[model samples]
Target: MADELELLRHANPVPVDGPHFGDGPLDHHAERHLDRLLRERPTISAPSPPRRRTRLAWGLAATAVVAALALALLFTGQTTAPAVAAPRPLLVQADSTPVPLRTLAERAGAAAADGAPKLRKGTHVQTWSMGMSDDKPPITLPEERIVRWHADDSHTEIVVATDPRHPGRPVLGGDGELVADGHVLSRQTYPPSWSDAPPQSPPPTDLGRLRAYLQEAEYSRTALNTGELLHAVATLLDTWTLGARESAALAQLLADTEGLRPAGQVTDRLGRRGQAYVYDGTGSRQMLIMDPATGDVLGLETTFTEAEPEYGVKAGDVMSYSAWMR
Candidate 1:
C-alpha cells in the first residue's frame, strides 16, 4: 500500500531526491525550454499546493525552510550556469504607454539567473506529518532541518539536517557528469530495510512505473514528495497571468488541487469572483485556496511518506497528478 501510494505520488510530478534536497539530474533540455518561455514573457501564473490546513502549513513551512537553507548554500559555494541571452517579444503602446512582455520575462529570468544567496536569512519553522511502521517507525532527525544543494558543471550535492543534535549527519548524492564518470553513491537509509513494505495484495497499476523514470531522472525531492506542489503551481500561475495560454493539462492540475472544487459562485477573502484553483485534499485541505487575481496562497494539505495503520495511506488506493508548461 505504501509503495503504491508513493508510486502514484511520484508518477507524474517532478522527481525529488530525498526528504531534504534533490539533485539527481533532470532533463536540462526541457528545463531550458521552460526557462526560455519565462524569460521572454511578461506575465505568468504562480504555483500552489493543496489547501488542506495541515497540508498547506506543511508546504509553506517546507518552502520557507528550504529557502533559508538555499541562502546559506549560496554563500558557501556558488552555483554557476552558462549565461544565455534574453529573447525579444512583442510590445504594445496605448495612450503613450508602452509595455512589453519581454520586460517581464527579462526580470523573471534575471531573478532565476542571479540565483544569488541572500545576504540576510530569516528563520522559518517547518512542521511535518510523519508516519512510520507500527513496529518500527522512521526516526525524525531533529528540529530545524538544514537542507542544502550544490550544482556545478560536474555534479550536484544535497545535504539535509544541520541542527545541533546531529550537526552534520546528512544523506548525499549527485548526477549528470558525476554518473557519466561512473561515480555511484550508495543509498543512505542503511540496509534498505528502513523502507520495508508489509505483505500486501497486488501493487499499483502500470501508470506507477513513471516514478522509476522520475527517480532515475532525479527530479527535485520536494517536487516528488508533495512538498513543492505549490512552488510548481506558483511558477505556472506566474506565467499564465502574463497572458500565456492556459494548457488543458494544467487546467486539470488546477482541478485536482485539494481545496479547489467546481462551484456556481466563489469568492476569496478579497472578494474576487472567479473559479479558483484550490487544494481540496483531506487532512487540512481548506487552506491552500486564495484569490488567483492576487496570487496569494494561504494553506496546504498533509501527506506523510512512511506507513501508518491509522493515519497514513493504504493499499489499492490510486493517486493522480498532472504537470504542465504555461
Candidate 2:
C-alpha cells in the first residue's frame, strides 16, 4: 500500500508554477551545500491537481450527485421526503362500558349540593401525564387496573389501585387539599404539580376577586346583572387549570349545561379533559365549546346556535372568557 501510494503521489504530484529554483549551477560552498540538501530531501507528494484534472474531478462529483439524486427519487418517489401522516389523534381505549356523562354529572351535582358521598369506582387504563407527578415525566401505563372515584360534599378523590410499576397506591384527592388516605398513598395536585414555589401572584381579577365582591354585595341594594354574571363565569373558565378533581368537575359542568357547546375538549399538560366557553353576556350571541380532551385551554367551540364564523375563538387566540371552571 505504501509503495502504491508513493507511485500515485509521484504520478499526481502538482508542478510548480514559478521558475525552477535549481536552474543555475552552484557558485559557492554555501550554494553547493544548499543544493545538496535540496537534492537529498524527497519532494512532498503534492495533491494539488492540474487544470484539466480539476475539471475532470468536478465533473465526476457532479455526476455522482446526479446519480445519488436519481437513486433517491427511485426509492422515495419524490425529491423531498414524504410528509409524515399527522400522528393519528391518540385514540384512547375507552372503557367498554363507559359511565354516561349524565350519570357523572348527576353524581357530581348531588355531591355538590348535599355533600352526599356519591362514588364511581372503576379501573382506568390511561397514559399518565407528567403534570400528574411531582418528580417524574409523564409515562404511559398499558394495563387494565382498578381505580375509584370517591365523591362527597366538599371534594372528590380518584384512587388507583396498586400496580407492579407503582406498587402500593396512587391517589388523587380533591376534597380541598389532597389528603393521601390510601395505603402506600401517592398524591397528585392540580396546577400545583411539580411546582416548588408558592403562588405569588394576586388572585385572578374576575373569578377570585369578583366572586368575593359579588358575594359581599347586598343583593337587595343592587340588582345583579345577568350579563355580568355570565362575564364572571367566562373569566372563571379562562383562569381554570385542571388538576385531578378540577378537570373532571369542569368536564361534568360543561357536559351538564343544557346549551353549552362541548366540542373542543382538551387534555391539559396534566391529562385532564375539559373545554372553554366564550360569550357576550346578556345576548343570544354566545360561544361555548370544549378544548381538545387532552390539554388545558387548548381551544373552544360554540354551542348549537349558528353563530357567525367571525366569532369563532380558537386555540392560541387569547381572548379572556366570561367565566371558567372554579
Candidate 3:
C-alpha cells in the first residue's frame, strides 16, 4: 500500500515509524484541490467532430474524472474531519415501556415553587441546522447563540460557531471548510428598544393563561394538537428561560393535551440527560427532550421521514436540532 500510494503521489515517503494521520473529510479546501487536478488535465473538447470521435472523447473524459476521483478518495486520508454539518444521527433507543406524560407532568407540577419567578429575558442556545443548494453538497451549520437583555433595556447578542456535540474538535464551516472550534461567528449589541409582543414579552405562569399565550403567539390558533404543542414549546424556549412556575405550568398544559407519547430517556448534544417525547408529523418527526425533574425544555430535534434525493438528504437525516441551556 505504501509503494502504491507513493507511485500515485510521485513524492517521497517517510520511515515506517513516522506519525500516522487518519483519513480526512472531503471539505471545501479538498474540493478545490480536486477541481485543480481536473482542470490541469489536457483539454479534450473540439469545435466539431465526427460521431465516433465524439463518443470516444466523451468516454475518455469520463474515464479521466473517475480516475481522478478514485485517486482523491484513496489518497486524501491524512487527517480526520466531519464533512457534513451533523456528524451522525442522534437517535435514542427506548429502554423500557414509554412513560406516561401525565405522570411526569404531575411530578413537575409538584416541584413548582409557591411564588411566580420574575420575568426572564432572552436565551442561550446551541443549534445544528442542515441546508443545501442546487447542485451542491449538503452541509450542516452548528452555532451557539446567546441573546441577553441588560439594564435600561439594551440587549447584547453573541453567536459562536461551535458544536457541543464534538467539543474541541474542528467543525464544518457552514460553507464546507473546517474551522477551529469555538470560533466567534458574530457579536452585536442593539440600542435600547423593547417590545410588548407575545413572544418578546415574558410568558405567563398560570397553566390556562400560558396555554392561551402559547397558542396565540406560537401556534396562531386557539386549539392545538400534540405536535403543535411541542412546536410551541420549542418556540417559547427560543426566547426565554422559563422559571420553575412557568415550567410547571407548561408541563401541566402538555400533560393535559393529548397525542404526545413518551420515548424514554436520552442525553442531548450538550451531555445533559432528559426525557424524550416524540410526535410524528406527516412529513417529519419531532423529538422534544425535557428535564424530568423540572419539566424545562432541553432540546428539540427534527428528522425527515422521507428521502430528499434532490438535496442529498436521506429519510433519517436530521433537519435541525437545538439544545437550550439555562
Candidate 4:
C-alpha cells in the first residue's frame, strides 16, 4: 500500500508547490476531450476534474496528462517543443458601433421562431493555444479536431496539427519538433458509453433549464463569473451543435449576463467575419466571436490581460483560442 501511494505521489504534474499550481491547461480542452471519449461518446466538453484557475496556462503539464505521460517522459528527457510567443489579437473593426448582447439574443430568438435546426451531436473545431510553464517557454500550437456521434452512442474523434492561417508553414508537433507537413496526432472511436451525463446527453433548450444544465456541466455554482460562463459555452458547443431553440436560449442567457460587452466586429483567425464580445476577468481577458446573423458561436479567445512573470506569460499574450466550426 505504501508503494502504491508512493506511485501516486509522482502523478501530480501540477504540484501545489509548483509555480503554476491550480492553473489548468488552456481551458482543459484536451482532458475534456479525453473524458468525453471514455464516457462512451467522446466529445470535447467541460472538463470534469479539478476546475482550474481563470488564468489558464495550457502548458506542458496538460499535454503530458492527456497523453498519459507520453509527453511527461519526453519532458523529463528534455524533448519538449521550442518556446514560441503568443499570437496577435484578432483584428476588430475600430469604428464599428458596439452591439449589445441583448440585441443579438433577440435576433437569435426571432430566428429560432422561423425554424430551428436540430443540430447533430458532435464538434468540428479549430484551436490555437499557447502552452507555458515555469521551466519551459511558451509556444502557440494550432490544431483541428472533429468529433461525431452515432445512433449507438458511439463517437469518433480526429485531431490534426495544422493551422489554416498559414498553411504549409512548419508547425509545432507534440514532441516540440517542427514538422513541415501537418499530420494527424490521433484518430479514434469510442464505443457506446459510460453514463448519460450533462454534456453527452443533449443540452436542455429552455432558458432556465439551460442555465442549470451549464452550471451542472461545469461543476460550477449558480453565479458563474464571466470567464466560467464563457468556458461553459465552449464546452457545451464542443458536445452538441446547438439547434434553433437552444441557440436562442443561450443568446438570451448571455444577453442577461452582466459582465459581457460588445467590442465591435472583427475577423476571426479563420478569416471569417464575426462580432466580438469581451469579458474581463481577474488576470485575463476573453473575447467571444460569434456569427451575427445566425447567433452561432464562431470562436473564443483568452488573453493574458495581466502578466504573470512566474509562468512567463505577458499581458496581451493570448492564452488560448478555440473555434467551433459548423
Clashes of each: 48, 36, 1, 6
lDDT of 1 by residue, 58-162 (tens): 323334434544654576463431111111111112222221222322333343333332211111111122223333212222111111111211111111111
Q: Name model 4 segments beyond 4 Å from true.
A: 1-85
Q: Quote model 2's TM-score.
A: 0.22
Model 1 weakest lDDT span, ten residues long: 172-181
Pairs that clash in candidate 4: 25-58, 26-58, 36-42, 37-42, 40-193, 81-176
Model 2 lDDT-worst window of ten: 48-57
lDDT per residue for candidate 2 within 41-71, as digits (tens), equals 2232332211110001122333443455456
What number of backbone clashes does candidate 2 have, counting pairs of residues 3 or more apart or in separate chains? 36
TM-scores, all candidates, are: 0.23, 0.22, 0.71, 0.74
**Candidate 3 per-residue lDDT over residues 1-326, each given as its tens digit:** 12222221221111123222211123454344433432332232222210110001122333443454455457866254442346465656556455577887777777676544434776666778775544545567787665666676755555566665555555544344445665655446566566676676788877778888888766375577777777777778877877777878788888787666788887666666678888888878888887777677778888888988887778988888887765
**How big is the positional error of residue 209 in model 2, measured in Å on the Cα after superposition?**
14
Give the winner by TM-score: 1 or 3: 3
Better by lDDT, candidate 2 or 1: 2
CA lDDT of every candidate: 0.25, 0.28, 0.62, 0.66
- Give me candidate 4's TM-score against the actual structure: 0.74
Clashes of 1: 48
Q: On residues 145-255, what C-alpha lDDT tens digit does candidate 4 reach at each position?
A: 666666787666666666655644445654545444346665666666646677767887777888888888888766676678899888888777787777788888888
How do the candidates rank by TM-score, highest first?
A: 4, 3, 1, 2
